[model samples]
Target: MRKFLCTCLLFLLLSVPLDAQELDIFGYFEPQFNLIYLDDNYYQLQSNKLRVDLKSNLGENLEFGANFDWIVYHGKREWNYWNFIPERVTSRYSSARMWRYRFTFDDRSFLDNAYLRFSFPSFDLMVGKQQISLGTGYAWNPTDIFNVKDLSDPTYEQPGHNAIRVDWPLRAGFSLLALYSPESDWESSGKLLRLKGRWQHFDFSITGTETEWGVTDYEYPFVNLFTSHKRRLLGGDFAGELLGLGVWGETAYNFVGDFEDFWELLIGGDYTFDSELYLMLEFYHHSLAKSDYRDYGLNDWLRFFYQEQKSLTRDQVYCLIQYPLTDLLKIGGSTLLSLSDGSIALVPTVLYSFHENIEFTLIGNINIGKEGKAYGSSQGHSLLLRSLVYF
Candidate 1:
């Protein structure tokens, strides 16, 4: 399928007349190295990623765009050490998934974006695989269902999804968005609706999403059960400035069939001083999480690591601080604390710019806690170095 798509894109590029339209080609190359220490074991991994983006205007009201990514991995592979566990695992469509496959697998290539868009006076229509980003939170986005942020690198580009999207501009600084992502049948498809506008001094959005979700239950070491249910999510987010500081809030209420309903909330703010020091803090709460770590079991740990669940604890806090040591170099660090279990993760980072389009980054992560707790001492730490060159 990837080969066929690449051929079609090549054909389009060749058939389109240069005089009629302008084609833009650009992208980047990045290589990253990782050294991890976990459970008294040291592991090394390296990955190189290359991406090429293509964009063109087909006509006055039509446009086409696509991006292709090829990545190669070396060192460690195959880390699923739970063969004794049940085969019943939840699908990663509706919730977050660890994305650890990138580091634990061989080389791969895929298309991240391939879409055609049409513009009109009243609304705009987009079809095929495209990028869908929603919500106002930085590290956590409760109102966003299409993609989940990686807490370690929250601003990285996300994989695209195949869907049909519509954007309609409304009167009085408001707009409406609708999206449909098909599955094997309409009854199990994913759908979303959002109404966004500015009120007073803040920008706000109300969003609703409906989809099917699957989860696996275990009965000790011998029995396992799998169940599917319809899940509905309703949420809203707001971002604005207050008293010389930037503030944002996001919340979501989830209703899962036959399962207990829950609410997730996040509140955050950031400020900068005259000395070029930056500070940011955010607090998150999960109503469905277990309040005691002693109640957690093996199944719960698997679910949390696989990203089928959000967190192992009920409450958490994230704080970040940054300062510029020189014009070409900057230093920063962040701390993630699980308020429920007294576990914490500290990450320090340094960034240097070699040239206008070349840069390097170094990051170190240290986890601290009891042996069996979340972000526990047994998890150890890791260091990562990444270099990027843009074209």
Candidate 2:
């Protein structure tokens, strides 16, 4: 199997030029240093990551793209310390690392406008390993959050998916989308099928997912909702600007079994003070269901869910302010307060552009919460710096 895969890759590479195609390469590198301070001690860590994407565009509506990522970590590790330490009495420090790579096929490799579409005027199709974001909020996707890896400990690393999708454009500014996935490891082993539609400023979706919850597997159905509008409702210099707001909400129910359900709601908006400055705020509430598979059986799936248990009801309020220091420099910061547990967190970021294609960014995050709390961990603060060159 490995030999056959290598042969196919070799053929593709060799035939690129012969096929009269355009080859484009793009990627970014991020190397970070972190200093995490707990109540008693401080942990220092360093890590490096590299990602590259190559695209071969064959004219006449055919294209292929591949992506490769490498991540390495060194120094003492914290956060989720239990995963690294088996013994309670042992104070061992460890190094962590992982890597992933994927490839995708699509009609066009970049800048997809309605005008460029020809093959299927009313329909669009995308397949293979790709990234999908399904909602307006930064982190709420009850129906499709393919790239959300960790919830308790949030990271900048986005989640990706391997799936097939079909999109149909309806009349009068309306469209419909359908997605299917044979496998998803992040959602505790699940096969998913979803359908969604958008009209004007409103969006709705429904998904049916079957996964192993415990010794007894079950299927869950979820519904997602999103609405947004950018219209002027007030007077003054902000008259022509957007005065209306946006909102998103979702709720889920379990089918083929009796269990608790989950739901989430978010409302927020962005207002521009001027071209170079803006402010935004959002409020979120999540009600997660509790599982009882462990009480029924001692199965591996049940045990895994128990060990990875999460909270049931939480509230988050956040605010962000951004400013452009110059034509090439920009800075922004955000603060999040957890209402249920009364925890606070902060993230600060800065970006500098050297030219049209070269840019640098520095970002950092810190969580201040009580020990044994949802956000508490051995790793207190983390930082990352990145450089990108686009072509």
- Best-fitting candidate, scored by lDDT: 1
lDDT for 49 (candidate 2): 61
Clashing residue pairs, candidate 2?
A: 147-159
Runs of candidate 1 exceeding 4 Å displacement: 1-18, 81-103, 218-226
User: What lDDT does the true structure give each of the candidates?
Assistant: 0.79, 0.49
Could you tell me every candidate's TM-score relative to the true structure?
0.88, 0.66
Relative to the true structure, candidate 1 reaches a TM of 0.88
Residue-wise C-alpha lDDT for candidate 2, range 209-323, written one tens digit per residue: 5553432221111211222111111100000123364345554443323343445555666776757587777666655422221112212222223332123226666677779
- The stretch of ten residues in a row with the least summed lDDT in candidate 2 is 230-239
Query: lDDT per residue, candidate 1, 1-391, as tens digits?
Result: 3455457556655667778678789999999999988656888888999999988897777788989999998877555423212223223121223232112477989988998788999999987688889888888888776776767777889898877899999999999999998777887888999999998889999999998766666433334466778889999999999998999999999998887787889999999999999999988888877667665565666656555567667889889888998999999988888888888888898989999999999988888767556666656688999998999
